[model samples]
Target chain A: MVSVQELLKEYIDEGRIKLDPSVNHHTITVHDPCNYVRKSQMAFGDHMGDLNRWITMQCVDPSLYREMCDDPMNNFCCGAGGGAWAMPYDEERLAYGKIKADQIKATGAEIVMAPCHNCRDQIMKGLPKVHDMGNYKETLYLWELVANTLVIEPWSEEEIEKAHAARDAQFERDGIEMEEEEE
Target chain B: MAEEAKPMEIHIDRKNRKIGGIAPELADRCFTCGTCSGGCPATGLVPMEGAEGVTWDARKAIRAIVFGMEQEVVDSKWPWVCTLCGRCEYACPMGIKLMRSFRAARTLRERDKVPGPIHKGTMMNLERGNNLGIPKEDFLYLLADLGKELEEECCPGFYVPVDKEGANLIVTINSKEPFGEPDDMKFWWKIFYAAKEDWTVSSVNWEGVNWGLFSGDDPAWKEQVRRIIENARRLKVKTILYPE
Candidate 1:
């Protein structure tokens, strides 16, 4: 089960996806999701910490990227894992997330790239309300960062026709009917 | 002579000694080094209010379980407070898998007693195939609407294919996106279009977020996983892309 991160990395490496770092000229830091890093290290022996940083670095200017004090495997949880985000223990959840808030504050980055939904919600919604993160600007999903920065080359007429043909063939092979639509 | 202090008579509830059938020996190996608590962000968060000497930490919770006070651990808000992020396990000197015990503690709680919307969400996913109980028709409508918006916004020929057999990939969407941030769904579609990936979204049981994993319902977790797998197999897809 490859992550969008993995796929993005592969695409970027293969020259299929080109990222334009100037899309969002803001200081950014990556928040490592627990499952992706620490737990993954325990279970898979590969922390994927470096991979996350690699992706983040690719999306942002090198000068604008900031590293959190505790990176990856040692990174603090956003305190929303284990169903805490949906749980009734808001008070406790916020208290636990305080550690993450402080970590982000120390980084002094305008944006936090949280790959996990739970972490993104906590950092984006839960943290700033209680913590003093005046410098914090936005939280982005890693894929969102990539999507926003992608340098999409408009498809040529031939490419568009070929893609349409391919799509029609796929539908036909799958025995699915497609409504008439412009390519 | 001062009256002899009566030895603290403790009635051990053997029933609570083991959490969700997790081995007591797992807890028995604790070195009581307190490293887990030191690293644990939830150390003192849930005080089990009004209960004296009831504070939370991985070490203390393990001790409670080891001492047959597992019921107290489960009854309190401590288990819920712990995110089971595995920091305690990572820092454990004895190589104890603390998250297992914590997850087991979550299982010990009654479903209704399970905190917040997690259990309910899991049940909804089990019954209706998605959290938030969004019906299949509404989900499809949302997908089609959002796909059209995405096409107009960026991708020219992008339409989210639903249940397309023989597709290379079956992708699941987090229910939250369709419910609240529908635009977030475009991020993936934009990427898929650029890559020209052959991916199909299952109209039924297509939720990416599995609350069962969080709620400590093993069967529900497995069932949710099974549904995703079944969708992938039904579509004859080689990959099941679940970002959550």
Candidate 2:
């Protein structure tokens, strides 16, 4: 029942994934997904709002990270939560998103890390067009941000062979054909 | 033909009123201090019908529900606009669970009246295993292609394992990724390859999102949950990572 954010943080802490913050230069801010953070807090008595912050902060330069005026649990929705993004209430959704657009503008960050898909779409595609954003550049998934900054060390030939063998064995066990590669 | 409209009457004696299992009488705990409304971005945005320069807010919705105005509240666009973000509950001095009440309001709407694409998407997700109704062969083909591309990019031996029994993790995906943003799928696979974790993606009923929560269809959402659990059991996976 753990989120991928938890798993990513665990892997990083365990040294399975190494992050290089120097690879990224743009100022970034993390948008707290309401369902992922606030609602979960109300229901489960615990949330990963802080963990998401910790993960995002690890992926960028210390100076490049920015915080919105509102803290994680108290942050504004991207206006797309509760299926508004998929719904036809474009007027209301965009009107609600004006607050988020302002928050991003105030941060002056080039990138807004939206961990949830709905937040990402609204922040990236829906907000800036109407809000007249100046500093806003792009939106990225929390994991995508980490993946881009990953410092991948090349594996040895033996390690490569072992991984190949393991993958092949997995496919075989699942009764899947390795030869069915799509063109 | 010009009969005057009657003013909406409030039922003062209707005590112990509940909406979607959440008691609307809890509105009595509210101070009407406007903290919830002020903190909510949805406030003042729901334009008041037949009136100028006025709108509804969370506190207003609570009051409406208390007055046994469930049908009016259900028909209004107020609940859908709220987004159920929990900011009001988070900041309420009265410690009111505003989002829960709002979610309750959402459930009051008729299925046909549930706002755009959500009801249809829920039905599609139930019938075809995804919101977009992408067929199994197409989904599998797209995954295989993406897997090969990711393998060629950085992870040489990388492959998206489907329905691998006894894996430690079973992952669900948002239909949007495979439908439009297929490249985004690689971010997690890259992580999986790096960690060398034992995880498998289910070939069928792999959608991660349950829009029933949005449309207020509790039964539909529950059925969606059941499908995921059934998939996990079929694969014998101990963990379900629904990263929506």
Candidate 3:
């Protein structure tokens, strides 16, 4: 399987993508897929170092990033894998995912990037219903976050004004006072 | 209270009982080779304390069966915990189908006696045609609602067709996508749009999450498969795509 984190780093390195200013200001956490981080052994071997370097180069803080499980190579199955999702073990499956959900919540990051489909589904379902971790922080695919950050095209002044107006409108609707930030 | 209790007698059903097989013979043939256990994931799960344990290690469970100790295997928790990932079979020198045997033992148990919530989900799927039990009409409504929202907000001219006839492909989605995480449906929709594939999602039996297969309910499994196949035929779709 293609390593999504590596792909994102390569895009950033090539100047083909840039992080959204809003995202850079907010805390972001990534949930390492067991298959990618452990089974593939790429997370520790090389990808981890590369990803850390890239994040620093981008001026994004890494404190929000959480440590993965100990002995991740032999990590407990996420209960979604090996057909557990289809099996008659909802409570057990939910119980298995509790630690992962707690780990994400402890980071206090505004978003959790889940790469694998099974992990994503389990986290999305188990986190909210079982763990009662509400939808305050978004759960996104790694690619989606990278896509958001890439500076594909510079917005025209008019487009920028329109975007600001939308943001203001959202703030007004949420009853929050807005303070302009220095560029 | 002072009366002596009669001795309890155990009765064995011979006709329904399974006899021991070559597994024990093969165990006897082993020349103290550690090759099999070294590669087996379940090796540590089983108890191995002494000489008898080692001699019967390979066929210990098999010997239990041959000796009519069926409860030893049937009541064990090992079967449910095994993921059946096939790692053991691949590494075993004896090429033993330990996982297959475990699965067979699980299958022999009565439905109610089978441990796990998967069995209940399987029964639900059989009775309601989907494990999540969203009524057929409700499922259609949700699809329609999502299709409208997508077309209005994100993708113009995008439609999630339901039971459309003669479509090139029929796609089945997990019910959880519609019931719990509706936004996740957008990812697959985005992919389909990029590919520009002709496809239709069925109003009936559209869920691809087959709990029957996981719960070892063959009749329910067949019913679920039949429902999907029948729907595909009705829609005249040539191919069925099951998204992960």
Candidate 4:
């Protein structure tokens, strides 16, 4: 399996992909997938450098990044492995995912980037319940953040003006007064 | 006169007692080594309870099968509980290869006899496109509607290219998302739009989850894999990305 983190790094470092520096600087933490960390050995191996470089390339503060639990080869399962999610032991699986969710919450970062699909699913579903119960914060995928930051073609002045006109027209139709506010 | 009164003696075939044609040489190879049992997560499961039963570990189970003690091995609950994590193979000193032996024994058993709901799910997946037996039209409609909702609600201008031919990447999504949590499908669409990747979701055989792998059904597993490959081929996708 390809390491999404490494792929992200290659995209940025190799100049195949570019992200707006301002958007990329947002603080983030990565939830290492057990399959990627332990099974693929990407966390501990030379692949670690790729992730470090990728994070650095995004201009994220080094102190903001938190280490995963039992990270690298010894990382704990995100509770979705071995078809655990589909089995009769779903409660157990979610309970296990809570550990990872807790780890992400401890980072206090705005965004959590989970590369694995199972980890993403489990975290996205379980974290909100955790948050509702006052346990942990929410998690998002690494790709989501990277995608959000990509340096795509900016909207042209004409397009921006058109969008502004559309918004004003909608507000006018609703009889809502628009006021300019200072930042 | 006493001998004449003796009841007719019947001899049972002790050799036939072997379970699943277990061989004696395979049994002899096991050195009562605890390596297999030590790493096994299912060690203390029923019948193989605690340390006393540790001796009848995976290697022992294979040995009993090999020694024509099929009844003892088959009746043992150890095989059903084992997750086949390959941790035992990693920890074994003698390289006993117990999991393979157990799998062979499992294959020998009838489909109905195979343990767990996962096996049944595999059969369902083989017969239906998904383990849930979701009709193709329903699957497509669910995905299409979810994609539209994502574009309307969470992320506007997002497009989930369904059945787009000759895309750069073909992504296989797990059926769980579309079936259970349709909104979750939005996340991928958002990512794809933001990344500006040439990606398309297939209308047919797009589920990435392989139940056959979990059920130890190779043919079913291959069928699922083949479906994905065929879809990608038909679409002329350069890469088939597995989301899981």
Candidate 3 residue pairs in clash (backbone atoms < 3 Å): A18-A149, A18-A150, A18-A151, A87-B118, A88-B117, A88-B118
Give the range of the ten consecutive residues with the poorest summed lDDT in model 4 chain B: B17-26
lDDT per residue, candidate 4, B73-156, as tens digits?
A: 555545544444444554456655565556555555567766556677777767776667778767755654565565455444
Candidate 4: where are CA atoms >4 Å away? A1-10, A14-61, A64-71, A74-80, A89-183, B1-42, B45-80, B96-109, B114-117, B153-157
lDDT of 3 at A43: 22
lDDT of 4 at A58: 75
Question: How many Å off is the CA of A66 in candidate 2?
Answer: 1.2
Task: Give chain B TM-scores in order.
Answer: 0.93, 0.92, 0.76, 0.78
Clashing pairs in 1: none
Better of 2 and 3 by TM-score: 2
Better candidate by lDDT, 1 or 4? 1
Candidates, ranked, DockQ = 2, 1, 4, 3
Q: Write the per-residue lDDT of candidate 3 for residues A1-183, one digit (tens) a residue.
A: 124455345545665455554455556655655445443453245324335334433534555454444443433334465455555556656765665666666666666666556666677666577684433366665544554444444335575455346434533543444244443
Tens-digit lDDT track for model 3 on B59-122?
4544445446656666654445444433333334665554445555566667887665677767
lDDT of 2 by residue, B1-244 (tens): 9989999776755554556247545666778898999888899889767668879899888777667776677788998988988889888998776788888878878888888889999999989988899998788767767887888889876778887889999999999999999999998888887777889999999999899888888898999999999999999999999888
Q: Give the best candidate by DockQ.
A: 2
Q: Residue A66's C-alpha lDDT in candidate 4? A: 54
B17 Cα displacement, candidate 1 (Å): 3.7
lDDT of 3: 0.55
lDDT of candidate 1 over A120-169, digit per residue (tens)? 99999999889887579999998899889888766666765665565556
lDDT (10s digit) by residue, model 4, range A1-183: 334565456556677666665654445666656455443442244434236335544745565555544434333445555555555655445554555565566666565667666667666775456433232345565665565666554345575455345434533543444345232
- Candidate that beats the other on DockQ, 1 or 2, i.e. the better one: 2
Candidate topping lDDT: 2
